[model samples]
Target: MTQEKFEHIYQRAEERKGGETQLENLIYQPLSNDDLRCITDDRWLAGFTEKVFQCGISWNVVRKKWPNFEEVFFGFKIDSLMMLSDEMWEKKAQDPRIIRHLTKVMTIPANAMMIRSARQQHDSFSEMVAEWPSESITELWDYLKKHGKRLGGNTGAYALRQMGKDTFILSSDVESYLRQTGIIDSGRTTKRAQLAANKAFNQWQQESGRSLSEISQIIAYSCGDNRVL
Candidate 1:
């Protein structure tokens, strides 16, 4: 891309600070306690709950079929998912309302089991996740790799962080924030973006003597959209 185009994209991103993007506001934002309750409600779980089953699918597709998925999956209740037999799986496998990938469909029940097991070991799911170690980046990564069996990888770790399960310095959005801030010149390769973002963030931390929260607000203000970058 031309320098002019890059600058334009950077500026657009900066303009988005405080303003909400569809992804940031509607989709990727962490769920509230009330939101979780609504999702897990008995009636909601009865027919509309398989939304989480689409973990590896593109978010766009998941969002599109979200209602249908709820209709088909009985609202994602652990019991509803647990009740799925091979016949039900086969039936839903052909359903157009959800991503029809068999392996992902199958993993829902397995994931439910894991969630239940975590609850059994701890008093609640949140408590269990809280017990997960978060002292170091390496430990955080390791914990994600081990327990996030359903979707745990770097991307999964990032998602978990967004969901408040873990705390880490790296996230895809943060990488975008760094690029928009002109902190590093590297373009979109994952490794390059990660390295650039991390270096920039560390530098910003030292130079401004600001907390991550404050820096994040600044970054968010500075780089709101990719159009400006």
Candidate 2:
């Protein structure tokens, strides 16, 4: 099915958000490839872990304790984390400086390894992320879901977005918009649904000359009960 032009969507978003300036202010632009390349693997692991911990929990709670998390996780240094034993990870889980969720705590080591593996194959984990083609972003998402622990569905997408990857998140509003538009007729996380969303976003990107990040936010702002001031 043919989707509505991105111009119409952007106009509705501008109207909902009070005007063009307000909507533009609300949209965050993704970093360029060079900027993305400079981000270290440790920071990438940290970003991923933050989103993993924030999943299904109050982001405020995670935000407040984030420094302590950095401290307890040894700044998320990939090599140091890789050297840690299971016993060390267990101690980390029990540490009062951060949340005591063992499952989430364990993602640190697993994701660290994922980054390390990427580093071995490419110049660095950041380079791999930077060089990944936007045309097949879902494939990168699939790689993370396959190779990293607890990074399936929106978790990996959120992490990638946080680390400046130009990928659209399948947020609730975006998913609803897709479903309403007949963009996908299956489960939101299914491969078919992701590819469909990707194609629509590509079309919108071509039409608007906006990054996926901006388009995703615009699509979100166009629908839903987002408050305007």
Candidate 3:
């Protein structure tokens, strides 16, 4: 199977979305490296926590409870999270202010340590994230998966997206498109599959001069039963 060019994908997405204008309006642009570097570490932690908790749960529920999450977690401040004792953590799991899942609640401190480690080594977690090259985005994914709790697979990718990182998501529609083009095989999270996806996205970026997020959106829009407006 031949891989389609970005132009073809964009054209189909535009048609599905009504027009170029409409399609562009719907695209979520990523932040520049400068802007990404300016985002505080607490925000990064918050993004990761949101995505982690959102896994296997209703995003709307999480969103509605986000203020409580911030309050209970102290805005996900790294120092505050690191200071949480075992008893405090247990109390957090049982607290009605946030979701009462112990396992998910435990990930907060672990991920906070992950962020702190990066900041300790690199001066700030934002600097590390902003300096990561988009061409090898899967490496960043791997780092988060290895170092952070429950941040593997789409969880980390979605968090990165939420934090304005330039990376592609393996959404169902994007996965279908990749499968049709033979870019990935059985599992999207496997090393081989991730590498293949990275290479393909790099090629697409070279050809189209678009961000990975834009390319991902176009691929998703092209293959799915998206509403035509």
lDDT of 3: 0.90
lDDT for model 1: 0.49
Q: Of the candidates shown, which would achieve the greatest lDDT relative to the real structure?
A: 2
At residue 33, candidate 2 shows an lDDT of 96
- Residue-level lDDT of model 1, residues 1-229, one tens digit each, is 2122333433444455434453134222333444433332233222212334444567677777777766776666777677778898888878976667776666556555555666566665555444553323335444434554444435444444445442334445555655555754665434454454445544555565543333444444444343322
Runs of candidate 2 with Cα error greater than 4 angstroms are none
Better of 1 and 2 by lDDT: 2
**Pairs clashing in candidate 3?**
none
Instruction: State the displacement of the C-alpha of residue 217, model 3, in Å, after optimal TM-score superposition.
Output: 0.7
Question: Rank by lDDT, descending?
Answer: 2, 3, 1
Poorest 10 consecutive residues of model 3 by lDDT?
Answer: 220-229
For candidate 2, give the lDDT.
0.92
Residues 70-157 of candidate 3: C-alpha lDDT, one tens digit per residue: 9988988888788878999999889898888999989888888888889677978889998999999999999999999999989999
Per-candidate RMSD, Å: 7.7, 1.0, 1.0
